[model samples]
Target: MSDLPPENVQQYPRPPRIEPVPHLVVVRLGGETIAETTGAFRVLETHHAPSYYLPPEDVRARLDPVAGGSFCEWKGRARYFDVSAGGQRAPRAAWSYDAPSARFADLAGYLAFYAGLMEACFVGSERVIPQDGDFYGGWVTRNLTGRIKGARGTEHW
Candidate 1:
């Protein structure tokens, strides 16, 4: 019923894959008002690298505004935040890519943390930095064990 050539049809691109990067971030600050939590998040294994995403209502930790932010095509515009442990400030440790694309809007306002800057980071209680650099944020959870992976800029994964 068609007139086009068989090879003319192109397959649609695949969505970015988000594998779980198992890890835990423990917060121990001097302030009693702000609670300390361990292994309270999840990380994304993206094409560019890994990024940490924390459950909004699940995080017992308090966050303050940081100095910078940027835009993500798949996600959206983001805002950075600072974290405090024992009342000690860990600058720009949190970020939220608000107003993400329809497929990835779930990421909106969900905080992503950088393990390298936190007080302590553990991969299955092994004390490892999931990724090898400071540019990525490795997602984590309390009991989950695995690495997250996804392709950046691609809407479908």
Candidate 2:
């Protein structure tokens, strides 16, 4: 738990809100820093953990294009990236919506990582917890509260 006040994920907007994150975001894999950024964006949706998106220039590791992709109604088609560093590789560990919807245009060219696939992911001084489930890339920090989605019983949420 954190000393900060709790923020319920349920309070986030339905369509999701994309906003700039003032804190530092970092990602590590294979004992190497793959991505680090002081300027990043966060996607907050109701009952879901906030997904931090880092700018392309901020990523320090190599990102190789992966075959196949996914679709998001709000963010448009998504492409996957395989992160490689320090002789370690995490396939499809990152994703980006090159041409996002109008509401999420700011996310274009930005990348979001999966905490479970990386050695570590951080927001400020806090290490993040991967949202439950393999498909969702939500990041859970100490400041968040409420029953988050992505768990077994939350399939309908």
Candidate 3:
């Protein structure tokens, strides 16, 4: 639906590629801008949507540690965060890999949000679509192509 050329997720690397994102990224919730950054990083993997991790300093929302955590083979363990802003709360809507593997060291302190839990998430001036499923925190943009993972049949991907 966008004029921009589409990129297939199948073309992305397997072990996952971490790259700095110079474009502005923003997250809005409850009529407030909870996070905004031009210094974010993106993790692109085969069959998955791109996950944007924003610097801690760029997020305006208060984050509280959640009770449970998850593990990622490539990033190590991930801790969840409850995002609170403008008197609204979204529990465990964000996550961070405090001590990521050496390959993903840049994401150690950055937080990746679940776009479905927020009022809106943006990449540059374009609003993003949250990758389907509650577990994966990928942000879908117009530039991405191919069938994304995270749907029911994609559980094994």
Candidate 4:
């Protein structure tokens, strides 16, 4: 268990902040482990669960780049990736910011998986609950507290 205080999403920053995650992060799909890493970074934003980004080198499966991209005011351009393993494919299930803004430049090349699209995702031994909707890639764990964003009516939040 971590000695740090319990995290409440409500108290996270509006612009978001990145923190190093020492726990093991794992992504499972198509009945196999596609990615596993002890080194992960999480982006914390107000009203949202943490979005964990794994290093590119730690990912086992090949991520095929998708056509579209998006812009994050804080992070810069976001690129999509399709992940496949064991005959299952999740289109645009992952994303990365190649040219992030200076403040978030550390996120460059890190991949954040959509837990809902994968068979399972875990933080250490605890299975994570995916943040609602396909838009945000946050992962909700048992240790978190507060009303999270991403539900239908919370679009403006």
Tens digits of per-residue lDDT for model 1, 1-157: 2121121102212344333433343433334323223324342333333354655664556688877788765566789888775667778877887676776655666776666666554333444344434445653333223333332433342
Candidate 2 residue-wise lDDT, 78-154, digit = tens: 99999999899999999999999999999999999999999999988888999999889999999998889998879
If both were scored by lDDT, which would come out higher, candidate 1 or candidate 4? 4
Report model 4's TM-score to 2 decimal places.
Answer: 0.94
Q: Which stretches of candidate 3 lie over 4 Å from their true place?
A: 1-5
Compute the lDDT for candidate 1.
Answer: 0.50
Better of 2 and 4 by lDDT: 2
Models ranked on lDDT: 2, 3, 4, 1
TM-score of predicted model 1? Answer: 0.58
Rate residue 129 of model 4 by lDDT: 91
Better of 1 and 2 by TM-score: 2
Task: Encode model 4's per-residue lDDT on 53-83: one tens digit a residue.
Answer: 9999998876899998988888989999999
Best by lDDT: 2
Model 1 ranges with Cα > 4 A deviation: 1-15, 19-49, 123-126, 139-157
Model 4: pairs clashing at backbone N, Cα or C within 3 Å: none
**TM-score result, candidate 2:** 0.96
lDDT of 3 by residue, 40-146 (tens): 99999998999999999999998999898999999999999999998899999999998999999989889999999999999887799999887788998888888
In model 2, the Cα lDDT at residue 83 comes to 92
